[model samples]
Target: MDTQCGDLSAQSISNNYSTTAPPEPVHSTGAHRTEGDENAGGFGELTELPIEINERRPTCLCCGRPQKVCLCPFMPVRPLEVSTCLYIVQHPAEESRVLRTVPLLAACLPPEKCKVFVGRRFNEERNPELAAVCRDPKTLVLYPGSDAENLEDMKVDFSASVHNVLIIDGTWSQAKDMFHRNALFRLPKQVQLNSSISSQYVIRTQPTNTCLSTLECAAITLSIMEKNKAIEELLLRPLRALCSFQLQHGAQVHHSKEHLLRNGIYDKPMPTNKRKIKRMEQLVSNSTL
Candidate 1:
């Protein structure tokens, strides 16, 4: 990939955003039904909801947030466009999430600069563009594997080389599964952020100490690679404000699940078999009837 730096210094910002909300549920009365209706005697002639409940809410296009929690006002005036490309392999499930950071990241960069590929498996045939970037010699995958090198330790000639940075956007387990299953990801040199700075994603619970939101991870990586610390602050402005707004409006400040378990503030439940035995027994008895 060519490092053709454009004149992004004069980029203009816009604040226009959509205002929409989840449609309120309208109810109608009908017969109730139970599970396993194929076996017969499942229908109940009682008043019940006839309409299917739709949980998905309308979102603002600019911020990709629910109208109520839209963070467009807090977004930066202009995105800090960089020379390096950011390839985000996102789980398809993440698209419907109300509170996601990918949109914010997208808003900060040009479409070509930040590319998102959504799927469970990223094969060369399915995603040729992503595969090509992964195959590039300068490309690096941001992961904390045993053989991973710290971001700061790996020196790069920015002017001579434009790196294709691969970031997997998902929960810890989902990301791990994607990384393990995807052969393309395995080819790139893995890099990790060794800095001790804590995550500012207060609205969501991180899994571990090193875990970060996709936006935060990308911002930090860009800041380090571009040698401009301002990118981190610029990208995070809306995120921080989003968390603050949510906190003020009754959202609790969440701690990582690991932190909660370690501090004894919350306990990990027993194994699935032990925990669900009673429920399973009751379900079996009900089914027999």
Candidate 2:
């Protein structure tokens, strides 16, 4: 996903810790020695030039944000205990986004409760664990489609056993590509959240008004699985703080593309592709209805 605040390009933080050795000092040869060195009766040794250090903005180890705008304070004092496990199948691009919400979602939950896998392809041979989870009857994939069951209306017995929830963290197009490419995703029970609430991730533009961020999706899924509404609010605390901080720091509030199109306020150029043009027309028609 290319989610970010203020149109900032994606920033990557290197995890490698290998230290580079300083370069060897240059020694003056007899032929290259200056006249001053001859007058001093000794070879003038060049002082070692100081190595330039690459200075980066100080970042918080926990939330992965700059220290000055750390979101740790907004996180829960302790990890929230939950029976439902979240498996976030993230796109490779999301790992480089600076203002992603996945970190916030993970920070609010127990380490084991939230597992992230980064890749576009998954199979039983290479991803046995994920494959097993997908085969389990208790597993549910949060994806929207004509066949997907509504999460709000689905009935499940939480007392029987914990459920595994698979969420694809990417743009709509990327997510759809992954879902279609991987047959394992179709094995799980497909589900969708039909909540009417608008997204709280004001810093990033969404495809539609009902579209939610990865964090919001997880929060709602967990709250429903655990049968506790409080989980949703707890998980969203850091996200709310993050948006508030960004808005205060000059980040504009971005409305959804659907909203802009419906109101005739969309200033961007219309798509040239016939398929895209039809999609846009459908969005405008649906919004009116």
User: Which candidate leads the pack in lDDT?
Assistant: 2
The TM-score, computed over Cα atoms with residue i paired to residue i, of candidate 2 is: 0.81
lDDT tens digits, residue span 160-229, model 2: 7988999998888888888999999999999988778888998888877778899988888888878899
Per residue, candidate 1 scores C-alpha lDDT tens digits across 1-289 of 0000000011244433323332333335774544444223322222222433345566677766667777778777766679889998888778766567887788888888898888889788888888899999899999876889999887777657788899888876678788899999989899988777777888787655446789888888899889899988898888787778778878898776556655667565633785455533433343210
Each prediction's whole-model lDDT (CA): 0.72, 0.81
lDDT, candidate 2, at 40: 39
Candidate 1 lDDT trough over 10 residues, lowest sum: 1-10
Residue pairs clashing, model 1: none
